[model samples]
Target chain A: MKCDFCRETSVIHVRHTDKWFCEEHLVASVEKKVLETVQKTFMINRNDKVLVAASGGKDSTNLLHILHKNFPKVEALFIDEGIKNYRERSKSFIKKFCKKHKITLHTSSFKEEFGTTTDQIVKLDSTKTSPCSKCGVLRRYLINKKALELGADKLVTGHNLDDTCQDILMNIFQFNMEKLARTKSISPGFVQRIKPFRRVSERESMAYSIIKGFESNEGACPYVSESFRSLIREELNDLEFKFHGSKVNLQMIFDRLVPNLEKKVMKNRLNKCENCGGPTSRKVCKTCQILEQLK
Target chain B: MVTLEYPDGAKIKVEIEGSLLKVLVKSGENPEEIIVKKDGKMIAEDYELKKEDVVQIIKVGSKG
Candidate 1:
């Protein structure tokens, strides 16, 4: 089949638009949509100091590459979660890419920041809480601390459409309306976070990475399957498979309905954590609480 | 036999013919997270394949 735009053979059938794209067009299409997201959402400014969370996984790697191309002062932050067989390998790809492209790369870790690694957290978590939950809290804490230290104006994360949609759906299932509303709020000591790829699907990013010749298959986080998000992701993907553009449609509805409804929900006023001075709705932040539990 | 190539470098050879989704399910690969191609051109889940086809499967974002 030929691409909807050109004469080249179509390499991807975008079922949502019922359009097809060849390799070159696919690359262009993905980049165009991401840039459009940033512009339409007013996510970035030309002179802003942008810090991207680069995991060296396909999505992050692609995000980093695209941001570097568009912005002048884009740097990368990689938080080592201390996962055996995961973090060590993923770092290499980001490190190499950053070096080759001459982009400044900053890194921190759970061990250095919180006195423990994810591997240790998984073993020490007697409560049997999800490692992703623990790791996420700590990683996020470090990202904010580091981003503030770097004086970043905006912190960019590689959250694609699928991830955001899954998060919204999960929040809905939990009846956590406040949490959904909180996603748009900026807290003290946390750099403003942006998701330029929130409109881009994971599959499109994967295809973009490979087609652009920098795709890295660092494998899944070893503990990914155990998390509830994994289950949600699987269910959502299956739904998308059954109904083309289901993920995109859900996101469209969320973009339209959820935020409007969010205004009715009382916004949280976060206070500084007494223990760590981080922003939290409670007296202590989850990061401090999680570290205390591990200890 | 259709020669199936995976991103993990596993070459799977099987007598498979039918939609890509069916083949992925039978091969224990989740169609939801995979992109299939027949000779470098992306194929949809419903796209049909025949015997002797060289199919490449690219695993997308990692799932648990």
Candidate 2:
């Protein structure tokens, strides 16, 4: 097979666009898409200090690489949930990659900040809550705190097309319109969040990682099996298989609907958490509340 | 003849020269999770196969 753009052999076939690309063209296309997404969404400004949430996974590794290459000032922030074997192994790759690229890397751990790891939290809670539910709260809290302390203008995440589509579907399935609206591109009282790969597929990210020789962590989190997001991801993948471009269309619908939903949901005033002074809609932040439960 | 390689390192040889979709269907592989690439370039399903073309069908999706 030949590349659609040239006589060179094709390396990637994007089904939705019915295009073939050579290695050079494939890399160009992926980078162009990322740049386009960031530009069209107004995800970043020329002088912004971007803090990338690097997980050492394929998506985050790719995100960090793309952002560092394109942006003027970029740094990596990693939240270590203290998952045995997983966190340690993932951090090593993050450290090496950052060092190799000469990008500044900052890390915060649950053990150091909260005096407890996710593993211990899981074992100690009598409610038997899903580990992901607890882990996500703690990780988000720490990430936000670090981003703020580091004076980042925006916090960039590795959320790809599949993940964003799954999240929209999950919220719709649960009929949580408020939560869905909060997933919009910009929100108040929080460091702006951006997803440059919001239009890129997970497979595309993986292929890019392999082609670029990024030392991405290949292991899965131990608690992922019990998360509802995993189930939604599987279902979305099945739907995308049955109907090509389903994920893309889902994200498009979400993008169009978010503005209207935000108008309705934005009325709920956000308040500062008395404990950590973080933005919270309730009397206490979710992170502080979770910490209280642990205590 | 065209060669299709799966993620498991299994290879299937096809004598037919047609689009990537036809090749995938002939190989009995699910097109959803499988992406076809030739010489490390992603090809669309409509890409016509030429003789001696070696294509890799990578299985891609969200990992746990």
What is the alpha-carbon lDDT of model 2 when measured against the actual structure? Answer: 0.82
Pairs that collide, model 1? A225-B64
Q: Mark the regions of model 1 whose C-alpha exceeds 4 Å error after superposition.
A: B8-30, B37-48
Tell me how far the alpha carbon of residue A289 in candidate 1 is from the true structure, in angstroms, after superposition: 0.3
Steric collisions counted per model: 1, 9
Each model's DockQ?
A: 0.54, 0.33
Residue-wise C-alpha lDDT for candidate 1, range A151-252, written one tens digit per residue: 999999999988998889888898988778777766677899998888788877877887888846458889988888988988888888778889889888
Highest TM-score model number: 1
lDDT per residue, candidate 2, A17-131, as tens digits? 5676777777777788899999987888989999999988888888889889989999999888989988898899999999999999999899999999999999889898788
